[model samples]
Structure formats: structure tokens, C-alpha cells
Target: MDEFAALTERNRQLSKAMMQSVFELACDLSGLGPFPEQAAKARGTAPVNARLMQIQQLIEQLRADLQGLRGPYLMQQLQGLGVDQHSRALQLHIGSGPYVLDGWINLDVFPAQLSTNVLWGLPFVDGQCRYVFLSHLLEHLFYPTDAMALLQDIHRILEPGGVVRIVVPDIAQCIAAYQDGDTGFFRDRVEHWGAGDGQATRLEHFLAYAGAGPDPAWLFEAHKFGYDQETLIRALQRAGFKTILPSTYMASTHSALRVDEHSQIASAKHGDRHYSLFIEAIKE
Candidate 1:
């Protein structure tokens, strides 16, 4: 870690020095200040200019690559493909890390159906999809901006009357369990994820998802925002969705979206309380 930090600083310093040298030479050459025959030698800058142009092109390409993991856009551009109406329905599992749904197109940043970053936008025409499933992904997006952008895009891509099932770590449930000192709840969660022996660590289990594993996939699941039932409902409503409902494990009206990791975790003892919030909303 120390070596990485030192190397990063050294690279920045070297880049700054290189830029300064280039700028000073360019200024000196332009005015013929250093040498009497500098005007004739000015043509030598053509190679430097060409190299800078190439560098600019490379920088622009990197900018696009960083932000333009646009799966649908790339599909259309590279493969001449877009999500057309499926023979049945266009179902999308956005941010589906490893849980690949058999029938639905598993779209995620973790190299699923397409390496898609949902924060940019879904790669489909408006009203092309029938159902979208977001599993424990919303909280990872920054609140009211990035999170809301994803929600608004989901509304736009769904056919009218289409549905979105959102899941997130239930902040309210976690808080309640902590207040009531429900060790069993914490115990179960810790055991399932295989960490957190104490009350505080177990509580941390529900709040944070990102720093748990070495995999980049888990790194993406960091809880940037927290959501309870009412807060989630209001966010959905703002995104132009209607008919929002607080749902439960394996109880979705949409049969295909009922596929979740929740059913196994929710215990029979704690009134079947799930560690994650399940909510569904309609694009109306």
C-alpha cells in the first residue's frame, strides 16, 4: 500500500515535469529566443505535434471507455443489435453479480450478459422491456442523483405498465434488530455471510457490502445509500412509478422476478423477516 501511494505521487511529479519541459521548449522555439537558426529548426516540432495528437486521441478513447460501458449503445454500434421485443418478454436482471437468471438477460457490470453500467443508462429503446429486476443494487448508487438516474432510466425503458422489483439491505429492519438486541437476527446474517462474531461487527454486516471480498464484484456493492420501506417508495414515486408495494421473499406477482437469494435467508423463527427490503413498482 505504501509503495503504491509513493509510485502514484512519483508518476504525477514526472508528468508535471514533462509538461513543464515541453511547454518551455515550445515557447522558446516559437520566438527563436535560444538559437539564431531556431526558425528553421521550428519544423522539428512536427514530430512532437504528431505525438501529442496521438496522445490526445488515446486520452479521448480512455475517457469514453471509462464512462461508456454502454452495453446497448455498444451493441447497436458494434453488433448492429438492440433489444427488440422478445418472443415472450424482455426481462433484465440489472446488477446481477453472479446470480444469473435462466430466462432473463443478466446485465451487470460484473461481466454478465453485457458489461453494463446502469448509472449511464440501460441499452434499450423506451418501452422495450416488460420487467426489470434490481437486486441489492440501488443502495450502491449515490442518492437522489446517480440512484435517481438509474430509476428514471428504468421507467423510460419499461413498457407502460411494466414492473421493477428493487431489493436492498433493509435499514429499518437492521435498526430494529439492533435496538431490540436481537442477536439471533444478527447471528443468522453473520453466519450466512460467514463473518462478524460480535454485535457491532454483525450490525456492520447489514450496513456495508462493498469491502467484504477481494473480488471487484463485491467492491461494487458498497452501500452508498441506505433505504427503508417508505424512503424507497417515495424514490420510486419520484421516478414516475405508481402502484408501489412492499413485497416479501418469493412473493412477487411477476413469476420470473420471484427468483431471488432471499428465500434461503429469511428465517421461519423471526416471523420470516428478511435482511433485505423487497419492493415492486409499476411504470404507470
Candidate 2:
């Protein structure tokens, strides 16, 4: 284990060096001055560049494989390929990750199972998915106009009666949890769950500020905006999704819709915080 740890540390340093060298080359290509420290610092800032995030995710997967841990994104990719442990039928999965949720195809811009543009190119989209799962994904898009247009494209891609399962952090829920007394507790929860680390706890409030770092608050700086339940419902309606009642939705719940234990670990019991939400909208 100690040898493994030593090797991991050594590899991390090597990876950083390789990444820095690449960045330096990019700067040279663009006629910029040396900024190795700045480049390294940029690597950690919020609103992580999509391309950089993809690279980081790939590295993390490689590290996981080296450490004999499950490669986080591999399951999603396998699920996209219909080789998942459960052997479930796969569909379209935009921005795949930790959850290789059943029925998602694991699409990204960098071309794994599928590739799309900033708005998920509608042209290459296979109009066959029963459900389009965007778990913790949409928050990274920068332009709402482009995003709405993409949503429209998504609307076009779904078969009749298909559903777009959208999961995102409920910003209003966080605000309410923070303001209705017990500010400190909710703040801590927001920091812990929102940023996925301890540093964000200190800058939680800055999330509301424009141009703040992505690592500071919210899931990503690319999280250009957020929504409350009402706004999200309204957005779905505008995008041609029939708003599903929680009871009815839960009643007809597909096997894929079951929330996992990890997803629920820090729910209301964990300091009255509001972290995430899943909404299903059927094309009517």
C-alpha cells in the first residue's frame, strides 16, 4: 500500500508536469508569455473549462484504475455500450459520470460513446432514447439561450411519450434552507455538498455573485444560473414537457428512476440542507 501511495504521488506530479508542459505549449502557440503558475492555478478555478474538465475526469479515471478502484466514468461508458453489470438497455446520457444510470448513452463533447457540441449537437443526436438523463449536467452550460435551444433540440430528439429526466441543485431550496433560520447549519451543508470539498464552505455566499469562481460555490461556474421548483417546472412546460406530479411520477416510477443511497446520504437528515433535485418531464 505504501508503495502504491508513493507511486500514486509520483504519478500525480508527473501528470501535473505533463499538463503544465501542454499548457505552456498552448500559450506558445497563442503567442503568450510563460505562465506556468497561472496555468496551474487556472486548472483549479471554478467554471472549469469543459475541455479541461474532461481531461481531468480522464486522469481521475486513470488514477482510479491505477489504485485498483472502480473507474468512475467507465461504468457509465459501459452502460452506454450495454455491457453494464445489470445488462440494461441504454439510452442517451448527456454529461456522464459517477452514475452510469440505466438508459443513458454517456454523451460528451470529447467523444466517448457519443459526442456533441456546447449545446449537444442536435444533428448527431439519435432520436430513439426513451429518456434523456442529464443528472448534474445542465448546470455547466454557459448560455441559457443556447441551452434553451438545446432543450428544444432535446424535445425534438425524444420519441412521443419520452421523458427528459433533469437533475440539478435546487437553488431556491438552498436559499430557503439558509434564510429560514439556522443559517450556519445550512451554509455548511451547502458548502459541503455544493462544491464537493471543504474550501467551498468559506466561499458559499460568493456563489450568488456574478463572475465568482466555480470552485467557490454551486456545482460549477458554468452553472450560469439555477432554478427553484416552480421555475424549473415552468421551464419544462415552456420546453414542451408535461409537469409530473410527485405522487404520480413516483407511482409510475421506472426502475431507472430509483434514487441511490449515496444520492440520499445527505438529505434532510444532514443539517437541513438542500443539495439536489430530479424532475421528470414527459413530452405531451
Report the backbone clash tally of model 1: 0
Q: Per-residue alpha-carbon lDDT of model 1 for 1-284, expressed as tens digits?
A: 59987887686566566666656667766776546354335865545456668978986897689565555455754243344544325787787777777767777763456665776677777887889988778877878899899999999988888999988778787777777887787776656655644555644655564223222323343567778899999999999987898898778888777877533432222446667788999888
What number of clashing residue pairs does each candidate have, in the order they appear? 0, 6
Instruction: Report the poorest 10 consecutive residues by lDDT, candidate 2.
Output: 260-269
Candidate 1, superposed: residue stretches over 4 Å from native: 1-61, 65-73, 76-88, 196-219, 261-271
Global lDDT of each model? 0.71, 0.55
- Deviation from truth (RMSD, Å), model 1: 11.0
C-alpha RMSD (angstroms) for model 2: 10.7
The runs of at least 3 residues in candidate 2 whose Cα sits more than 4 Å from the true structure, single-residue gaps closed, are: 1-90, 109-111, 118-120, 123-127, 181-203, 206-221, 246-252, 259-274
Q: On residues 149-189, what C-alpha lDDT tens digit does candidate 2 reach at each position?
A: 76777777777767776766667665665566555655556
